[model samples]
Target: MNSKSELIKFEEGISLESGDNLSSFELMIETYGDLNDSKTNAVLVCHAFSGNHHVAGKKSNGEIGWWDEIVGPNKAIDTNKYFVVCCNNLGGCSGSSGPSSINPTTGKIYGKDFPIVSVKDWVNSQNMLTERLGIPRWLFVVGGSLGGMQALEWSIAYPEKILKAGIFAAAAKSSTQNIAMNEVGRESIRKDPNFNNGDYIELGVKPKNGLKTARMLGHITYLSEENMDLRFGRKFQDSNSKVDGKVDFEVENYLQYKGEKFTENFDANSYILMTKAMDGYDASKNFKNLDEALSSVSSELLIVGFDSDWLYPPERGKEIQLAAMNNNIRSSYITLDGRQGHDSFLFASEKYEEIIQDFVGS
Candidate 1:
């Protein structure tokens, strides 16, 4: 599938759940396939942290989308059968209004002044976009990790708008450990000399080292110990002359490359804001409890967990399932046996793709 990204501006800005309002904003979105006459065949795919509107297919620049493996023609999500819509979240740096965007009021970058946006805010913004697109209801709303949390939110917050919800490798809220990890990443960026109080762009410098370290730490959490051992296993980078106290591990080299690559494209302020948003999201807080929160959900749910994903873990997914069951909501839980850790949902595998295909097909 060949896809093009479109930026749609909304003059009637959204009043966020936090009570802050943007006078105007734009959303970068990419769509695949075609909408049926009734617009009932729409499927919404929410992006996780660090993800943008490019979900699948190839851009004119020849760059393949992040989940191209599972979202093209005849693929898991099957763009050929359903109109797939994805957008850069409101607080994202990817062509969306965020910390990096210019503030109309001050004639400067929002930076630290950008309002704290919550998951509910994201869903609300997405809802506006949906309405603008003339989509009456979605056949499915699906995502993984932070994206999964958004999907879960949609099912509860707008139960009448979605038919099926797919939540993969996500928890209803961030655990203490997860929160701590996010805090550490935030600290790294804040402490960077170039950060300059989130004004690095104004200072004509980037927090390259800080963002690099943060991404390196995040990459570690995305993989399982078993997977790391199987792939790298303490292998040395080369047989060259040993420098005194030099780190030559192939895993270290890979992490360095990944970290460097991330710093080039991602903004430090956006990273901090996004991680904080993830940490602050607690889906059940608006209601009495998890079961109460899920009680109003009209969509059928499919929750998936990876056996090796210690980040969210299988138990977290099960907890959602238990809550949904308590409300007698139609839901299914599946734990995939994989070593890819929390990122298992992002990868395409026979079982994983098949499960999604069957769910969507049904």
Candidate 2:
């Protein structure tokens, strides 16, 4: 086992009970600015699945973060004022533990055998990180998409420890439609002959084709038809449409780019497991009911949704807002015009950023 120091220098591995025999792990973190004696200015930013702890600029490989536009010294997550800590989720394939990590007994990668997890399990991990990093209380927790799910979980799980929460382009629970989409991607991986029951790594032949197909499919869902029309349209990339001289459509080219780029670093097994966990998120069942669950969330909230996010439409976010209101928890909801659909939050929408900045400033 590698010591905490070699694991990229944050608070490192901190374990917690996640109701299973397996001890769910967390990657503790720290950021710029001193935590006052009161420790109120700390902000915890939860990442979407497939996102790493890197939330700002380029990595050592010169790859910038997905949220680079909103997280920086003076950006929405402003390291200049409040300290920020962003963690990889419990089932993530990042610096923290996951299926890719080696199993102690078998001494091989866990692969498809990683334990299932939940939003509560994820929050429990972050709580360990918060404690290890000496952040007794958080000024706010901010995130979007799956990250936003974690943000909502933070408020419910540690109501007394957080002052406010920002949930953008997300649902209180993962939608069935979203689950079906993710399941289709997972099944694509499983159906690949190269998968070999998740032990294909030993064969030196990854299920690249099936995974690419899945990525291509997922890329389609992340975009709205309107956004696709504005960006890709029916224009041909190869400018050929006779007896199929070459592939046509700019949208096809865009999807190919997305798929090819995804397989470079992503693992199919990790994708499957994380999507499973996300699909299991059931906000209503956790408490007496949905309203009761929202009542348990005592922190102030900022909920933002895109006009075109059909995956978890703005109406879904309105239900969350109404839940918060019914419970009388401090909450605000905003909708931004975005044709890019659910992915607008990731693509750096100007209106999105402005609202996030306004909330962060609060």
Candidate 3:
């Protein structure tokens, strides 16, 4: 693996035929380590929303991946042993095509005009990018949270193309409750005054406050009550609890901090669009049964869930495991005990890396 950033371009010749436009969808990708002669050592690290191609290392701009703790040279995804690659999702604000990207036809940002995205569409783009890189098949496709959804999509869509894969904190189908949460998050962005019908960028205004509030609302879903009690626990953010002050609670302060920092780089329109697409995903529509969907994949699966994760609970993973078992798929299960909730997958918690490392090794 080299420290220098390398731009691996998938030329239009080998890229996907875009349904929306004739222009090739560019995959702004970064690879760690070397692709073997057979190119079978490649492992795709799919990223969650708000993540970029700078998955494991720092880019030239100095900004790094959201999961910098993992996916490094000797880290869990271990770039030293396997060729690791992470591409920003299509319609993503990060390096990939999105609302922030310039539209060739309009001479303006794609904004709300960007076509609706889907899990299948994202997978198609990734499948093309991998092929263009000369990788025959991935050793595994592993991810957590929204990235976990992508991982599951790969297994369902091109099961034979991967050797082993893991899906963490995700469901075969986006549960209605999960979809509703996504809708509420979208509403926070859509109803913001600065949103301006998703044309705020043109009005010399960014939906910062609204986006911040949305993020704060989202931060609540990413945590558990136990974790909140341990971390916040009615603690005061400052000594002067009420000096004409508000947001006295540590949890409130914590959420506000998350919201403020997220809005600094994230675009409100991007948030709304991505969440909408996620809410609309349903693998059940394409399969006769959950087991049928599991049967299509030829890869080994490591289905993981956090016991304390309310957003996509452990039962969802058990349901996947049951389906896999019925299909006679080679699969294993791990339920981590963490009060970190859904976001536990991203942070350091227990032997998560070891579980993945061992699974891939098998």
Find the candidate with the highest TM-score and give its number. 1
lDDT string for model 3 (1-362, tens) is 45333444444622222355425455677778887887778889888766777776776688867777777777877777888888887777766777877766678877788777777777878888777777889999988877887888898898778888888888777778878877778887878888888877878888888788878877888888898999889888885543225677777777877888898888887888678667766666677888877778788889999987998898888888888889888888889986689888887544887887778776
lDDT of 2 by residue, 1-362 (tens): 00011142223443333445343343533254456667778888788766767776656688777777787766766766777777766556665666667665577777777677776777877787787677888998988788888888889879988988988888988887899999899889999999988877767778887888898888887788899888877887864422233456777776777787788887877788777767877677658777988877889899989888888789878888999999988899988887888887776666777777777676
Best by lDDT: 1
lDDT at residue 280 of model 3 (Cα atoms): 67
**Weakest 10 consecutive residues of candidate 2 by summed lDDT:** 1-10
Candidate 2, residue 241: how far the Cα is off, in Å: 16
* Cα error of candidate 3 at position 153, Å: 1.0
Clashes of 3: 0
TM-score of each: 0.97, 0.90, 0.92
Residue 348 accuracy (lDDT) in model 1: 93
Reference-based lDDT, each prediction: 0.90, 0.75, 0.78
Shift of residue 32 alpha carbon in model 1, Å = 0.6
Task: List where candidate 3 sits over 4 angstroms from the true fold.
Answer: 1-22, 59-64, 239-244
Candidate 1 regions exceeding 4 Å error are 239-246
Q: Judged by TM-score relative to the true structure, which candidate is superior, 2 or 3?
A: 3
